[model samples]
Target: MSEFDKKDVPEERIGLIDLMRTIKVVPLVTLHSPEEAVPLARALASGGVPIAEVTFRSAAALDGMRAIHDQVPEVTLVAGTVHTVDQARQAVEAGCKGVVSPAFSDAVVDWCMGSRIPVLPGTATPSDIEKAYDLGLRFTKFFPAEAYGGVKTLKALSGPFAEMSFLPTGGVGFGNAREYIDLPNVFAVGGSFPVPSKAQRQGDWKAVADACAQARQLVQG
Candidate 1:
């Protein structure tokens, strides 16, 4: 009955946990410098996919993630390729909305539970999916999507994992992103195609923005 803080409420719904679904596409970017973070994030935000899954594959990842969170406050940032508990801790500290791993990690999921952070544990097999379900997590990341049989595998899993939802990434590009993203079982899609590696390296914010705009049009059109 008393007043409660919104921060105290940890979102649980797949639809809510992964706000990327509303936008349809979530860019996975890894900028090398914090200075690039603001512009890159702004580009994506302004372009329409105002959401990004910034991964921890670089030394600048944490600070870059924080820079985006601070500068482009409207852009929802999620941490991706999280492989360690230390990385998970640092990610939340940097203001990431959720944690995504390339592979299932009980430790990472456990850390999220203890810290009250939304964690989209990755899955590739039935056992992996069931592990997430057993952890009371209905949402997950389907990594290496293309290499793992992509849509065919997702369809087959949908029979038993009917209630589950996925955020398929890895190999999800502009060409085939629509196929996986349009699925009823998929809440959203994540990939670096929207923010190309060369573009990021060259500080080409406009290119990133244009890609985001095109991705938005594809999802809407």
Candidate 2:
């Protein structure tokens, strides 16, 4: 691989991607309440998944991230559903190691690049992927994976973007997760099925952990 290839991404950025690949799954979490943040993070860690892509979909996102960062510091946290540069900055301030957006936003992507923070901007089409490549990013999030042809789409993309790898999210769950993970072009899978909604809402950490464990097994199998 050339120095500019995915294998040659900056050392710090490589570490982030390595962590994701090691875990094989990133929990796409939406905090319903700030109080559940620490416990949820711990549950994920106990379940063998220690990473979170906390979306900015809810109001508790920032405080939730802070609680996780301050309390359960072991879980690798990243911001998700980010639509603006301000959200990206807030995520970083909340101790997130990186940021993820549902769509490609120049301002957000540029801010992370300028700040030297690892980011995975969403790309659902060939044009979007090319734009990400033009920005010198080798890793990107493939959003609405199932909606836009899922595994078949990823396989087709491999031909044109041989050097680029993806973190496929949306419409991904236990039934189809292994298929995505098994793909050579996918680095990791992102979705919320690992942290069951009822488990999180009722503070049933063990149930959450069990779900996560099952997800980990799916990837291993």
Candidate 3:
């Protein structure tokens, strides 16, 4: 059985897509140190956004997720930048509520589906979206959003994939956040914009909180 089955999880839990829609913004985070996890999570919560997509881009990813899960339980955790099935399993073991891949990995998506774990496979083109759609997935991520045409691309996609919703990430910042979030098909925006690099490097939790609040405002407005 999967780790999720080993635990007593609620049967009627909120789906990740619905949760993301409500939150409006999902902060893509990369932790260089495990010690920053709790405070970073706390900051996110204080800023009115209590969700984090901890990317497996560093050695500290699992440890950081563990700390946030154990100490800052209110912050919803999603494993990001996943590339393989093993990493997906390790993410669930670390207490991630969902999984996000930078690209549509057949193995990872298949494993998540079999394990009943929410997965957002990345898509930058119609073909990628079509593959996820064929798998009965209506929610997916639009990666490198700006580079691939940003709002214009999403607008064009809305025509053919009207039933689909997206979490637009990459090149998403305050300036264009409102534009992305305003799109009817965009469920939420994702980026490191909410977690300022300088502030995080300095361990300035308050600045992080403020940045998150500002992002939340921008999207909500």
RMSD (Cα, Å) for all candidates, in order, is 4.4, 1.4, 5.2
Top TM-score prediction, candidate number: 2
Superposition-based RMSD of candidate 2 using all C-alpha atoms, in angstroms: 1.4
* Model 2: colliding residue pairs: none
Ranking by TM-score: 2, 3, 1
Better of 1 and 3 by TM-score: 3
User: Of the candidates shown, which would achieve the greatest lDDT relative to the real structure?
Assistant: 2
Given candidate 3, what's the lDDT at residue 51? 96
lDDT of 3: 0.91
**By TM-score, how accurate is candidate 1?**
0.91
Alpha-carbon runs more than 4 Å astray in model 3:
1-14
TM-score of each model, paired residue for residue: 0.91, 0.97, 0.94
Model with the higher lDDT, candidate 1 or 3? 3
lDDT of 3 by residue, 1-221 (tens): 13432243333223666678887999999998999999999999999999999999999999999999999999999999999999999999999989999999999999988888988999999999999888877778999899999999999999998877899999999989999999999989999999999999999999999999999998989
